[model samples]
Target: MSKWFCILLIACASAHAAPGAAPADDAVQVLNDKSLLNQIVELQHNVAEKAQSKLSAVGQNVSQTAYQVADSTAELVISSMGFLGLPYRRGGSSVETGFDCSGFVRAMYQETVGMLLPRRARDQAASTQVIDKKELKPGDLVFFNTMRRAFSHVGIYVGDGKFIHSPRSGSEVRVENMRESYWLKRFDGARRVAGTDAAATPPKNY
Candidate 1:
């Protein structure tokens, strides 16, 4: 009878030990779940950081572009203003002497922005895009056919429907209105050199 009782106690102890051993497998599974959660969190953080970096780069590019446009426009205005009232000489191209229509434009752009426009006014017109009369803005080159050619003369737009130019041999550099009867009738077209933003907003009538 004592031997039978010892055998029954051993069998009960073995059944309890089996359940305790299963906890080891459960602990390993819990650890694996924690590791997966951590990896997912890390991946999400990296994606967010990359997105923010890209946005900041785009913002900086836009800011730089705007600053460049403003600076270029200001330079154009200043350079054109300096040439005001200079005597007009046919085929001339330097401030030390005088300037013709195209020569004045060439010298101004070269001095201010370091860009070389085509020598002749007609060539300058052909080299640039043909912007509409309504799309005119400061820093644009306004062309004319005063000599009965397609683009024999040129000027620099100074906003407010006006442009600065050396009108003739006896005339000095001056600003004239595009809305006037004579200028409006002789208007040939417009041109833009490098560094001038053609996409800039057009000036409105004040």
Candidate 2:
């Protein structure tokens, strides 16, 4: 064959390479660049999708947090109510042994919210995040100076100026109205568990 024919055959063979056969160096470089570009485009698309997913998850968290306060309060109140009729005991922390006012408050929070509060009423008051009575939610604590001392008593505020507590030695766990003259006079303050006000403050990004 002529030289020209041989060159034409080689060109055709190069253009129509067999499956998985090694390509010419120039052709291989062009294919590699095209494959690399496709991979880059796929990576960019994947990154965008992942970012969108994260933003969606964050939005869901904000929504859940918005309702968390009310949910937690309701759960706490429900748990406290479950202990009604249990007799009072000094420094007691369980229904089996009975419960003091502070112990009742502590146990209720621990059971309902998985949070450990200070054992004594006064210590709990000092350690918690104080809030005005007007800001009280159902699960917030209401302090009282029943023993002629600051924070001698504590109760879980159950909304509408109502609270649940284990009264004195003779009484059992009970829910009472804070508006009653007896409780009103001794009302010291109100407080919230730290970081439980997520509903009031939402994430800035969302």
Candidate 3:
């Protein structure tokens, strides 16, 4: 198994400490076997094949930013996974300083895809292309009304009904099930950042 996969397993092992919560082994299986990792590989392969064929046919007409390939999206997901245990900090956006919900999402997009998103959760939601829940793919943005306001929190969707984010103060960056009651009720909407290239649109000033 890959080193990152081991790290993910370890993180999941420690993630569910509550007495009635799902078993750590079960969480590990859900995250690795049933969800994110496997889905990423499949998504990458499928998109790579499609991109190759389309590129051969259209040549220069294809805009890299206009249509994102799965490779970049997979990279984004893997990159975010590397920070699984990073601490949360309000208004923070770095390893040293930690990250907030929106800050974590912004940092991932900026670092991996060269896309600079709006700094706050609401602004990020307003700026991106609104997408249906059924249309959500790896690397898309998922918003939540955690603070009793629409789009008050944000995370990077990593497939299989899960998303990764810096949850709140005292909570480190972690992946959570969107199907869970708390999150399910608060889900505001989903959005997609269309570009994989560095020339994505500039973030609007908040």
Candidate 4:
């Protein structure tokens, strides 16, 4: 009777021990779940950091471009104003050799703005954007008909309804008002030079 009781106790103990020894697959599954969760959390953190870096870079580029545009415009105005007393040559286009009416306009753009305008005043007008006299701004081109022909003369508008130009053979480069009788009578049109690798491409709002 005592031996039968001992065997029964041992059998009960063995049954409980069998459940405590878990299967290998169950243990592996728990480990895998923890690893996957950790990986997901790390990935999200990296993506957020990269997004912030890209946004910062884009903002810096826009600010730099805006500053460059303002700088170029100011330089163009200063360079044009420097040639106040140069003589007018028939087909001259540089400060070193003087400038013709069209040449003066062309040289100012090339020297200050670093753009080569079309040689003829008429072609220069045609190549650029046509604007009304009322919309004239500094660095814009103003056309005239001094020789009884359209666009026979051209000058650079220098704000305040005034311009700088090389008038004729006997005259020198000078600033004159567009309101003068001779210029006002011959005013054909106004045009702004097209962006040719200078002025940062202006932003167009949608």
Candidate 5:
């Protein structure tokens, strides 16, 4: 009888230990799964952060490029303005001496933008791209039929529908408005130089 009671007690203890051991093993497995999920989430976050950083760098590069182009264009226009009021001389081509209508345009382009334009008003118009008046912008060449021929006179377009030009042999360089009856009647057309792109692009060889 004593041997049988001892055996029965050992069997009960073993049964309870088995059930407890199963729950402990399950707990450990759950903990490992949670740790793995956390690691995956952290990895995803890191990848997103790196992608954002790269996009920001590209945005800054584009902004800098746009700024440089605008700065260069503004400088060219301002330099042309400084030559205002210089006396006009027939066939003259330099600021130190004087300038004709075409000479003035050529000198301004050369000095400010490093571009050499054709020497005569007619030739300058023929060499450039013809654009409608509605699409005109500063630095474009504006032509006039002052001598009954297309592009007999040429001028640099300033903003606000105004242009700077050497009017005639006795007149000096001056800003004139296209709205004026005299200019409006004689308006020939607008032209753009070879390197000035209508579309946005990096500065081209002038």
Candidate 6:
């Protein structure tokens, strides 16, 4: 009944008829043409149904993946938050001993998502994929040049333009605004873990 179906029928009928000859009035021929049209219409309906089903399945998969990523990110951020006020030890990576900047970032990822990151700040930056500041999401890493070098310090971004890190010697792990004057001036860049599902396999060098 669609315009395309009508056009197809006309095209088929024209092809079957001889050039410049009138179509035959044979009853058998009419029945055959009708049968062919019905088959074609049924085939098109089936194809459309299959295509729609496939699209629906793909949409659901995408939504489920996105939800998993968001859930993983929330868990990582919440786990990091629980470590607030822990002392900043120079090379520490545990609750009993405390943690340094990169150590804290590495510990949270390992604990929450089972993903291990590079030990050093610079190495962590090199191992992950680079992303712009505006593209930062919860669980992404934010780098800073705290010690006169790129990526000397790292932290886990907790969204809303804020990050949590273990500041130097006497300070403890705490959240700070990236928009603050000192932080903004020292901001190096942002990097995202390779996988959205928070199950990224570290690179050989990572």
Q: Scored by CA lDDT, what does every candidate get?
A: 0.64, 0.65, 0.72, 0.62, 0.63, 0.68
**lDDT of each residue in 16-130, candidate 1, tens digit only:** 2222222223223322343322322332243345445544777766655655555555456545655555667888888656788889888878876678888888888888877
Tens-digit lDDT track for model 2 on 1-206?
13442344345435433334444343323223432223223322433454455457777565455355445654565456555556788979986687999999998888767789989999999999988777865567899999899999999875555677888997777667788999999999999898555222111111
Poorly placed runs, candidate 4 (over 4 Å): 1-58, 196-206
Best by lDDT: 3
Best by TM-score: 3
What candidate 1 gets wrong by more than 4 Å, as runs, is 1-62, 198-201
Cα error, candidate 6, residue 126 (Å): 0.3
Candidate 2 lowest-lDDT run of ten = 197-206
By summed lDDT, the worst window of 10 consecutive residues in model 5 runs over 197-206
Please give, for residues 78-190, the per-residue lDDT of candidate 3 as tens digits: 67776676778999988668889999999888887778988999999889999878777778899999988899999988777888899999877778889899999999999
Per-model TM against the reference: 0.67, 0.66, 0.77, 0.65, 0.64, 0.65
- Provide backbone clash counts, one per model: 0, 0, 0, 0, 0, 0
> Pairing residues by index, what is the TM-score of model 4?
0.65
Deviation from native of the Cα of residue 181 in model 6, angstroms: 0.8
Residue 98 miss distance in model 1 (angstroms) = 0.5
Lowest summed lDDT across 10 adjacent residues in model 4 is found at 197-206
Error of 1 at 137 (Å): 0.8
> Could you list the CA RMSD of all candidates, in the order they appear?
34.3, 29.0, 7.8, 34.9, 34.5, 27.0
* TM-score for predicted model 3 compared with the true structure: 0.77
Q: Clashes in model 1: which pairs? A: none
